[model samples]
Target: MMEIVSSTVEIVIGLLVLIGALFSAFSAFGLLRLPDVYLRAHAATKSTTLGVLCVLSGAFFFFWYFDNYISARLLLGILFVFITAPIAGHLNGRAAYRTDVPLWEQSVQDELEPLLKGKKMKYEEKDMME
Candidate 1:
């Protein structure tokens, strides 16, 4: 019975590792095939974050279960990624927009356009009156 249980655990661990690797591969593909900076950033941050998290979770389970030792470093790494990935992504996207990185042609709406336009208009009005 113990042997059977051990085999099952090994199989589960293998599956988790495989799934994480596949997600990471897909994330790479997305980064390559995406059309623009925003889309690429989305792939890198969103999918890569999930992929790394999955891989880390599998590693955590493997060490904790198989080795009978919980790894504080792994746990902390997981927590750090979960907390920081989205914030990093948001800041990158905002920076890209501020730098006037071109959006894809098919992108239909820009929520920032009016605000930017207003700022530009203020400068334009001042220059015209000078």
Candidate 2:
């Protein structure tokens, strides 16, 4: 019975790892094929984050069941990736926008333009006053 349970867990872990690898591959493809920085950032952060999480989770489970151990480093890595990936992506997109990177022609909307425009006007006013 224990052996059967272990085998089942192993199968699930394999599936998780496989799915994570596929997601990471798709993320790489998106980075290569996407037209603009923003879209690439979205793909890089969202899919890769999920992929890393899934792979880490599978590793976590494998250690827990097979070795009777819980790895703090793995847990911390999962938490870190979950927290930072989206923020990094957002910052990358923002940097590109501030530096005047061109958006794709088919982009439907730019939600940041008006908000940033007001900030830009304020900065320009301050500069002129100085």
**Lowest summed lDDT window (length 10), candidate 2:** 107-116
Give the root-mean-square deviation of each candidate in angstroms: 2.6, 1.1
Candidate achieving the largest lDDT: 2
Q: Give me the displacement of residue 4 in model 2, in angstroms.
A: 2.9
Measured on C-alpha atoms, candidate 2 has an lDDT of: 0.96
Could you give candidate 1's per-residue lDDT for residues 32-110 as a string of tens digits? 9999989988988888888888889889989988899999999999999988998998899989998899999999999
CA lDDT scores, all candidates in order: 0.89, 0.96
Write down the TM-score for model 2: 0.95
Residue-level error in angstroms, candidate 1, position 42: 0.6
The segments of candidate 1 whose C-alpha lies over 4 angstroms from its true place after superposition are 119-130
Write model 2 residue lDDT over 11-113, tens digit each, in one string: 9999999999999999999999999999999999999999999999999999999999999999999999999999999999989999999999999999989
